[model samples]
Target: MTAPRTGDQRLAGRTALVTGGGSGLGAVLTHALADTGARVVAVGRDEAALERTAAARPGAVLARQCDVSDPDSVAQLAGSLADEHIDILVNNAGVPGPVAPLTEVEPQDWDDVFAVNVRGVYLMCRTFAPGMTARSDGDILNIASVSGKRPLAGRTPYCASKAAVLGLTTTLAAELGPQGVRVNSLSPGPVDSARMRRNFTMEAERTGVTYEEAERRFVSRALLERMVTEEEVAEAAVAMIGLTGLCAADLDLSAGMVAR
Candidate 1:
């Protein structure tokens, strides 16, 4: 087989499975992967969204509905895809959880966040990693966040769950390295999305500020003085997947948010 070309065709022969691929950043990543020549399986709990993603890409993207937080669902997904070889796994399923002080946060809300952000990654890896280990050739990219390292008040569950993902990615890299499986994470700062807008709105209400002011507070933290874009995040993910030597690493796409 001809080796895949670099740039837009670097992933021509690869197959990537992306969780949370139905909408938002997940949808963007799915499109990016397909544009780069990889056959993509876009999995998430939203059937309609997943269908839309698949419809957008036609034959290049396959949509599957699976809740990453549920083991049984994930197992069924794994079983269904057993015949296909997945060269890349992107654990991008996550939840923002309740935006409230820890004291005011509900216990169940916290669990819900971890269920999708932390436990979801674990379950996906547990079910799909063995295939990679046996084949000894694959890449696993966990979508973490800058909040994992920086303190984000009123987002205890989200921050903690992302931090856990960072830890999980590092340790999994070590365990999978000898087996020729590379594991790494991508940590992006506040991306300009509907989700972040909602966060900013909540912050504004919580702090008695205007929405624009709340947004400024977040942007000011980054040296770029702006929020990252979904395209940037998706591009970085593609780059990470193509970097064969990058393992056990956490690449920061946080717009210098962690520099301080």
Candidate 2:
């Protein structure tokens, strides 16, 4: 008899929770972790999408509908999984702004984006950090954006939320270092996601150009001269979580688009 050869068994016997695992980068990440032999919990508000992702992976993935922005919802999720422990967590659920100047932006939009992007990440950490501390070997990866570092035009709330995530990642890494929990962030460049496409469309409408033109304009800003794919971002997240001694910092996986 021969031992089975598994690929990227780096995450074997580990459990991971990925928010926004229904579509976009989240879906790709879920598959990556599963391939690496981790049991993944796919959390998001979309039941159909979640089910599809879970079904695709069969025994390795479980679907759970969760809205990260809602403290109550997160609390319930934590309670439901009390018997289980998570070794890796990816805070990947977020939304871009409506592309308006700060003065013209509506309060509701600002609150909604914050509630999901910033507040949701905070709530998950608060609820799960203690468990990671107890385990003394856990990884928390927050999905930030390049907008978090450089101030972008017509995106006050979006930029503010991601900037806050960067600060949170740094501070949490410091606070949780002693407890053996590694907290890090990954800032992705313009990946071809549904949200990205919608934002491009909005920019095209605003600029009186076609969406294709807007996409080209976005790609022009990147040194690579191409859009970053979701798979590339997903691989980055998996590598970050697998890295050792990764505490209190963020990894800018933006493909040379943003400076350190």
Candidate 3:
């Protein structure tokens, strides 16, 4: 076969599975992966949202509904796709827990956060990593947050879960690297997503400031003084997947939150 043109898609001939592919950064990542010429399977608990993502990409994306935190669900999805060779897996499903001091946070609230952020990544890797061993070459990108590296006050649960994700990524990298599976975590600080906008609104109300002001203050803390965009995070994800030598490392896109 002739070599692809330089302008051709970078991820041509690859197949990708993105968890949390329904909304926010997840949806954007799905679009970005498909644009790179990969056949992407957008998996999430929200079937409608997954379908919407797929509709936007048409044939490039296949929408599948599966809750990454649910063992049976993950297993079922993995079983169905057992025969397919998956080149990339993005564990992006996550939840931002309530903003409050750890002392006041409910036990259940903490568990809920861990269920989605930590347990979700674990289940996905448990189900999919074995199959990837056959190929001995694939990418596993866990969508962690900078808060995991640098603790964020008033978000103990989120901070803790993401920290666990970072640890999980490191350990998994060691366990899977010899098999040729590159495992890493992509930790983005604060992205200008719809969910983040609502979070800004909450801060605005609580701090008695305008939404714009709250958002401005939020981004001002970053070295770039701006919120990272979803597309930027997707670009980082693409870059992480393209690298074969890098594993068990974190690709931070927090604009400098962790740096500070």
Note the Cα lDDT for every prediction shown: 0.93, 0.87, 0.87
Ranked by lDDT from best down, the candidates are 1, 3, 2
- Give the per-residue lDDT of model 1 (tens digit) for 178-242: 99999999999999998999999999999999999999988999998888999999999999888
Best by TM-score: 1
TM-score of 2: 0.94
Looking at candidate 3, the ten consecutive residues that score lowest on lDDT are: 3-12
Q: Which regions of candidate 1 are displaced past 4 Å? A: 1-10
User: Model 2, stretches more than 4 Å misplaced?
Assistant: 1-7
In order, what is each prediction's RMSD in angstroms?
1.8, 2.8, 2.2
Task: Tell me the deviation in Å of residue 40 in model 3.
Answer: 0.5
Off by over 4 Å in 3: 1-10
What is the model-wide C-alpha lDDT for candidate 2?
0.87
Candidate 3 lDDT over residue span 1-260, tens digit each: 99844322547788999999988899999999999899999999989999999999999999889988889988899888876788889999998878777898999999999999999999989888887887788889999988887756678899889989999999999999999999999989899888788778877876788999988877877888877899999988888787767899998898887677
Candidate 3, residue 229: the lDDT equals: 93
Q: Which ten residues in a row have the lowest lDDT in candidate 1?
A: 4-13
